[model samples]
Target: MPPLSFSEGFAIAAGLVQLFVAVVFLRFRHGRPEWGLGWWAVTFAAAGVMNTGAPVLLAAMHSPFGTSLNVLTMVLGISTMGALVAGSRLYTGHPRPGPWWSFALTWLAYLSLMMTRQLWPGYESLIANGVTGLIFAYLGCLSLGAMRRESGAGHGIAAAMLCLYIPMVAGAYAMGLDQVELRYWSAVPFALAGLGVMSAMMGRMRAHLRDLNESLEQRVADRTHELRDIISSLESFNSMVSHDLRGPLGGMAGLSGVALSALDAGDTERARRLFQAVQAQSSNLSNLVADLMALARVSNVALLKQPVALSELVQESVQHLELSHGEGHAQPVQVAPLPVVACDKALLRQVLVNLLGNALKFSRKAARPQVRVWAEVREGGVQVAVQDNGVGFDATRQRDLFTPFKRLHEERDFEGTGLGLALVRRIVERHGGRVGAESQTGQGATFWFWLPATETPI
Candidate 1:
């Protein structure tokens, strides 16, 4: 045997590397049965075999089997091309390579023709070049189509694929013409294509990782918002419990001591009055604690929605007010013909009652004390309004209206724990609604809420 050329040694080294790559691809195929990775493994392994076997056949160039080995090399080249196309098609959902039977006929012709006469250096160069060119041209089109079908841009990849055709086929044809040496350069095309395939796969893996990262980031953002909301609620609860309960509790203690002093002086009337003051303070503390508990309950309870008649709810809320405050407490409440809406009835009832109660409470000293509850149909949803001829507030402070434990009026002026409107806001928001008030100082207020119209409960 002739001594190995530099080209042969390079080919052997390349073949070993390719075989190692094939085994790695095989492992990937075992891990993930998708993407036709097995075909890639086969193609790489086959290319390694062809590269390793080429030098032996080159040494026996004059022998008949040398020609046969050359033909087998062509078959291996075609197989690799087929595998490349198949894997790409699987990866990108692009079109498949042509049917097997069509290539079988061309391969048969090449094999049979070679047996009859040596065609490598003659007319066979043209035929082989034509076949190889056609294969590459087809693959180029598939790549171009895949690039178009893919959402992401791969202009460079498409350009590289389109550029592969002419040189690859024309260069092979030049080699067949005995114009190019078959030393180290014989396996260059395989190496180039192998590198290209590896690059494409790596790009695909990168895209997949990027998508996973984006999804994880979105989840983190959502969790962060929830965390912020929880912290805010906890702060509200703490401030409310400390501020609200402390004032009334201290008043009750001071009143108790005053009543004891009055009883020691034998002033029964003064002691009785002080005892009543203590009872009032106790009631205020009780109300504050109850409001706190209600706020906590609203946060935890998931709303169960149904179709509720707003007009009827308004009338019912008026009756509740009349029962609690006096028979004529709801006389000023003028409810409009409201539209039916999908919402939690009990929650919405609380909303109407709180708003209506506020209107009544604030308008109690007004000469007329006219209260109006109306509704209107809007583009995205329904709007409900509670207008009262009462002590209206500054519009600038409207932002604080929905905040827990936020009160615009002092407790001495308006008896409340500042949780009523906050609870109303929570109930509305839970039902996919938004609340806002429109008013100027002493012009009376129109507190309104917008509820999104849904065919069914979400």
Candidate 2:
């Protein structure tokens, strides 16, 4: 019912400010408990309760309950110091062991001492102020060191405010100041310390946002580069379609017309030969379309890897080539004991078929045509090679041998859409592998690819 004193009014205001800080820290903990904001919340809440309870309890100091409240407030104030130290350390990524239990033990000891306060008489105020001053100085030193090391404005502010409290605590204890003067000294610094903690949290959030923004910008730049590469590839694909597809289509149209004219002129033999040429062109067109589709599928389809014996795949590929050309007996392919590999079965099969087919087609004209399939196990992976004793290419001149629609020889000598090796490269790369070729003019050629020996689940 009485009017509030200056100290009481200031204590209430300080308590409100500290409670607000506690609520803010509590909300932060709710979102990210991993950051350990709960410690600071406890620190500020305890300080708020101590300050807010001081005014009423100070007036009833002579009573039994008042004495108990006084002791409880002193315990709360000491606990706030411990919690602040613990919270600051954890926030900076350095944590003390058993902070909670250590402080609990400290409170129990203080409580025991307070129970016998009648024996200490006038020294109680000196003891409490001295202990609080020592803790303040220690915290100030810690904050100062952290501020210098981390260049944090919050730490600097906290260090300055906490250090300010040490001098005021020392003066109050040395001069035997009244409870009102002591409360004023403690309340101002306590409010500033809360502000400093709030600043530290804001600084952390700013740093996090900066890191997130940088990550997003990096992703955007990488995506832009990938888009540019895709555009360039599409342009090359369009060019190849226009040039290569148009040639075969034009030839077929002309050949069909010429054969029809010969048939009308009653030249049956000439018409029959022309019709056969048209059929050949149509077959080549079909094969080209098939290779194009295979290339597209290799680029788009995800790899499904599994353990497979290279020997079985090699034999199957050879048999397929033999069925396609009917001259497999003349080529005489020798497949060595190939190592087992972990790869997409279908894609790997396509790679073997293309490599073996190339070897057979190129070497078919040799006097003693021979093809060999082999594998070598290296440190981290296995190397598979398809070698042939056919007319090899000049490796130095044919730099882009694996480029789509890039032909090393004339189409008349070797019938191909120039997409086979490109498809092989795409499939190998998709499996996290590498492809290479070794060749010399008039000698043999070896096309090799390397794949990881261990199976990596997709």
Give the winner by lDDT. Answer: 2
Could you tell me which 10 consecutive residues in candidate 2 have the lowest summed lDDT? 97-106
lDDT of 2 by residue, 1-458 (tens): 58877877888888888999999999888655545689889988988876776667677776768778667766667677767767766665556565566456556656665777788898886666666666667777777776765646887788788778768867876797786668855886778877886887778778778888999999999999999998998899889878989998999999999999999999999999999999999998999999999988887898888898888888788777778878654257888887778899889989999999899889988898888987787668888898998889988766688999988888889889999999999999998899999999779899999998743221
Please give each candidate's TM-score.
Answer: 0.60, 0.69
In candidate 2, stretches whose alpha carbon ends up further than 4 angstroms from where it belongs are 1-15, 18-90, 93-152, 159-194, 207-215, 305-343, 363-390, 397-399, 431-434, 448-458
User: What's the true lDDT of residue 256 in model 2?
Assistant: 91
Model 1 lDDT tens row, 1-458: 77887767888776776777677677767544556667768877987876777676566666868778666766777667566556545545543453344345445655665675564555665565555556556655665665565443442354355456557556755666342243345355555555555556556667777888999999999999999998997887787678767888888999999999999999999999999999998887888878878877997888888888888889899999999889778899887788889998888988998999999998988999999988888867888999998889888998988787788877788778788998998898888889999988888999999998833211
lDDT of each: 0.74, 0.81
lDDT of 1 at 208: 70
Q: Which candidate comes out best when scored by TM-score?
A: 2
RMSD for all candidates, in order, please: 8.8, 6.1
